[model samples]
Each structure stands twice: as structure tokens, then as C-alpha cells.
Target: MASKYPRRQFLGQLAALGAAVTTVPQYARAMESTLFAPAGEKSFVPVMITPFTSDLKIDYKGLSALTDLYLASGAKGLFANCLSSEMYYLSDEERLELVKHVVKHVNHKVSVVATGSFGNNLTAQAEFAKKMHQTGVDGVILITSHFASREESDDVMMTNIDKFLALTEGIPLGTYECPSPYKRILTPATFKHLIDSKRFIYHKDTTLDQAKIKVKLDLCRGTGLQFYDAHAPNGVFSLQNGAKGLSCIAGNLYPEIFSWLCENVNNPARSADVSWIQEEITRLDDVIGNGYSLNARYVLNKRGLNLQVVNRASKSPLTAEQIKISDDVYKTVLQWHERLGIKV
Candidate 1:
């Protein structure tokens, strides 16, 4: 089959995603979520950041602007109240309102989902998930099961997921491998069972390892569960192996590039071209992992967007060294975008 993606027009900005695409097995080429949106919908979904005023107030104005920015730029969906939004730090009221605001503002122009389960116990998590569903989000995402010890077993998690399913009726469910308090990389067997169980329809994968990602994608191959790649370093590789979409934090910054990559993973075009483009994305991903919120604010400011007011418990201003590094990367990123003819 030939790729509908025009070779020269798209993926012209980034450095080199070519080598990375070659890592994709010739056999592992899937781009659609079997049970979700039809072909040509947005696949690069960004876990949105909560914009705040300098005084630490929820910046509704900023949120509105950011929301508009994402929609105008061709985002197929919006995910809110996730770790990228700093879910652990937000109060119940804030989380609910923010998800509501994003869903309502997006106005069904795109799919919407949010992480409603905070540090609350499983029962409370379920209740809150239902409330979030009432806010009109397409799905309510749950935090990864936390264990005081990382030695917890799949059997134990299976029992817990059952309880979550019992509580969250009527509303759809998703899971995130959020690493804040603790992170659980669901075992391949457990993930296959989760997909077979018919309760979970979404997964935010953080394994960050291509080998493991391949196993998970294999599990959900014929199911409706859409696996989103959370880790950025191997993002393009995962896409080739049939990750339904990308839930990368970088999407908020450069959605056009993300969308272009997502649009062409299964392209019948030159594999070298695809691999080089993926390498460039991984390069940007390297720059992003340095710092999450602060780095984003710095770039957003450079792009004439808003600054963040909320701070992590140990948050401090980005050091001069950090600022210079981010600015240099930012400059290169902007140049790349210009070369691709993407409107900022």
C-alpha cells in the first residue's frame, strides 16, 4: 500500500528520525486504534499542562488560550488532569473544574479524557472517576497501582483492577503509568488480561523500552484498547510497532511535528526518511526530559504563550545555566519549525 503522506511536504523540520524508523521491524507497522477514532483523526495527543498566573492562581485566560492553540493546530484530542498537569498537586475542586473546562471548551471537536484518581483509595478513585465522567470527558484515567514495595505481583493488581471496574460503571476507563509516588509497569500477561477483560479501553505506557512495548502492542492487537506511548525516547519505534497513538508531553509544544509523525508511521514512503525524522523527535525528547514544567514555560514564553504559576514542592526557578540550554534548544526548534513551514 502506498502512504498518503507526501514525502517532501511533511516531516521536513526535525533533525533525523530515520535511523529510529529502521529499528521498527518490517512486520510491525500499525497506526490505527482498532476501536477508537476512524482513520485521519488526531493521533498525537498531548497531556496538557495547567497554566497558572504568577500569583499561583489558576490561569483561566491562559488555559483558554492554550486550549484554542491546541485545537487550532489540529490536535485530535485533549488529555487533562494527568501528571503533566501536575495531578498530584491539584485539589479535587481544581482537578474537576479543569477537566470540565477542557472538555467543554474543546466542545467535542476532539476526544477528551482526564485522570480523576488522585492519591485517594480505590473506592474514592472510582467515585471521582464517575464524577469526571459527568463532566463530559470521554474517559476517566486511573493512576497506576502503587505498592509500598515494587515487588507486588500481577495477581494482586488483577484483584485491584477488578474493584476499579466494579466502581466505574457507565464511564469508560484508562490507565496511566504515572511515576510520581511510584510506577508500575504492568506485566505483559497482566496487560493482555486487562485488554481481554473488556473493562479498560486506554493505556498510557511508560515502559520506554521498545522490546516491552512490542509485547504490549501485541496483546492489544485485535482489541479496542488504545496504547499510548508516554516515554519519548523510543516514541517513533513504538509507533512502528503499532502503538495506537502518542501521549507525549512534547505534543503541547510542537503539535504539528507530532501530528506529522503520527500521520505517517505506517506510511509506505521511504523507511530512511521515517527513521531520520524519528531521530530528530528523540533529540527533542532528550531536551524535554531535563525539566518538565519549567522547561515548557520557558519555551511557551519564547513562543508568546503563558507562564506557569504553580510550583512543585521543591520547585525553584530555572537556573541561568538551565535557561541558556533551553534557549539554545528552543532556537533550534523554532528554526526547524520555520524550515517545515509550520505556523507557530
Candidate 2:
């Protein structure tokens, strides 16, 4: 179903969000208990992609439609304005507007988190995070790269992270090892630091290595932080070994498959089906990365969203072969929907 909140209500909420920036602690605490995910529950949180108009403006109508599709497809939450949303390419104001739109359109029906730490310094990051918190997001996600340089030691990163934590005070936080600006795969020690902070409620892991994932999961076993694997091929393994759920690029195309995998992967009776679907996801995952967000747009359009295949992150247009691959993958998703009895 579409958002019950109409355009008028959304604009009102956006204005409220702007004014509420001054009262962050009170508003954030009011929603924290309901917004934060409890430990041990599985989720499919799509790293949302921003849709653009032909003239390169934000296509808000398309964004709202996409959000509704995710909700209908069984997404447990939303990760908005992140790398998948082309955050780097978006202006700071545009990022806030995009997130506010999603949060209002979602009407607090599900948890929402957006990347907020964007400045060159920790103070700037904290200030922006507070502003983002006012947008009614469940939490503000900090990029791992923002805390440390590629050549810097973990200690340097920790020092910076500690400072940022102190600066932000009451705002809830999460971390993402975003691929751009170089991916900072968190070491177990660094991961432990975040868990121990009692501030981080989310962690999106990109270290496709399952052994490392297992160790980190053990560390965060009882911690409230929800660990999500960004690698789609490891979806089954990560979920089986106790990661909260998937937060991968593939969700941008067919979130229903991820939602179904999260719901049924642990069932003994569904083991065979699980294995088959995992293989399918792994193969399609590889294909989806070729043209990336553009190919993803193609698949979504094929599914009837009719989004303009425009992205600020990459100017590379999808090749003919890439479009063919996307078509095949769309058919595969349809087949999964039929076999799994997933209603579209």
C-alpha cells in the first residue's frame, strides 16, 4: 500500500523536522525505544538509491513510490541517504531533504536511518548528525572512512570515534564501512569498541569474509547493535551464523527475495529451497554489480516502477549486454516469486 500520509502531511512533517532540530535529545529519546531493533530478530534493510529526474533534480515522487514498494515487499527497515543513495554526489541540503521525505512518507511505520557524518572533522559530523536526528530517523549512521585515514592505525580511528561519540552525546549512532573513500573493514578490536560504547545500535559490515564476520558476531552476540552484512552472496551464511540481516545493493532491485530469505532461511523444512535461492541470489548478485545502480534501475523499471535511469554516482550507461543480463535476472526474480508464493 502507498503512504497514508499525503503530500500536504509530508510537507508539514518536513517543516516540523526543520524546526525540531533545536530539540534533538527530547524528540530522539521519545522515539528511540520504538525505533531501535531488538536483538536476534532478522531484517531486510535496503540501502536506498536516489532516483533523479531527466534534468538531474531529485525525483521525490519516485522516491516515495520506491519506499512504498520496499514496505510492501516486507522490508523491516530503511537505510536512506547512504552510499547506495549516491550520498557523495548529493548536496548536503539534498541529503537532508531526501531523508526527511522518506521518514515522513514512512510515517514511522518502520525504522529509518541515514548517513549523517559527512564533514571533514568530527565536530562538523556531530553537528550534522544532530540536524539529521531531528528528521525523525531512528539513528544516524557514520561512515567508517570519516573517522580514519586509509594508512592510519585503528588507534587513530578509535581516538576520533571516541571524540565524536562524546560530541554527539544523546544521539543514537551506527557505522557503515562504505566502499567509497576506501572501505575501512573494522577489526574485532574496533568493532568491540563500538559495541562497548553503548551508543551504536547498527553496524553494516562489508568484510565479505565469513570467519571475520563470525568472530564479530560472537563479540556482539548480546550487544544490542544490529550487525548487517552488505555482501549479498554471504546472505545465507551471515544470517545462519547470527548476523541480524542483509543490507546489500541487491535489495535495491528485488527486496522481496531478501525479505523471503530472512524469513525462511532458518526453517528446517525449507532447507532445500533456501539453498536453491541462495545460489540464485549469489549468481544474480554478481550480475547486478556490473552496471550497478543503472542496471538496478533497469530491473526496477522492468518491474514497472518506470524510474528514470539517471544516477549522479556514475555516468557510465548500461551496455547492451548489461541490459540483457538485467532482463534475465528480472525473469529469475519473477520465477522466485512464483515458486516461493510471494505476492507481488
Candidate with top TM-score is 2
TM-score of 2: 0.90
Q: What TM-score does structure 1 among the candidates reach?
A: 0.84
**What's the lDDT of the predicted structure labeled candidate 1?**
0.69
Tens digits of per-residue lDDT, candidate 2, 1-344, equal 11111110111122345654664453334223534344446899999989999887899999998999889989988999887888887777898999999998998788899988878677888888888888878788988878888899999999999999888887778899887777889999999988888888789999999899999989988666778999999999999998888999999888999999998989899899999999988987777888889888888887779689988766777889988888888888899999988999
The regions of model 1 sitting more than 4 angstroms off are 1-36, 40-42, 146-149, 270-272
- Residue-level lDDT of model 1, residues 1-344, one tens digit each, is 11111110000112345764644321122122222346534277788888877776678888888888777766677789887776766677888898888877777677787886653466766777778878877667876654223576778777877877776654566778877556778888878777766666679998987888898989887676788898766767878787778888887666666776777666777455557667777877767766666777677767777666345432677777778777887877676667555676
Q: Local distance difference test, per candidate?
A: 0.69, 0.83
**TM-score, per-candidate, Cα-based:** 0.84, 0.90
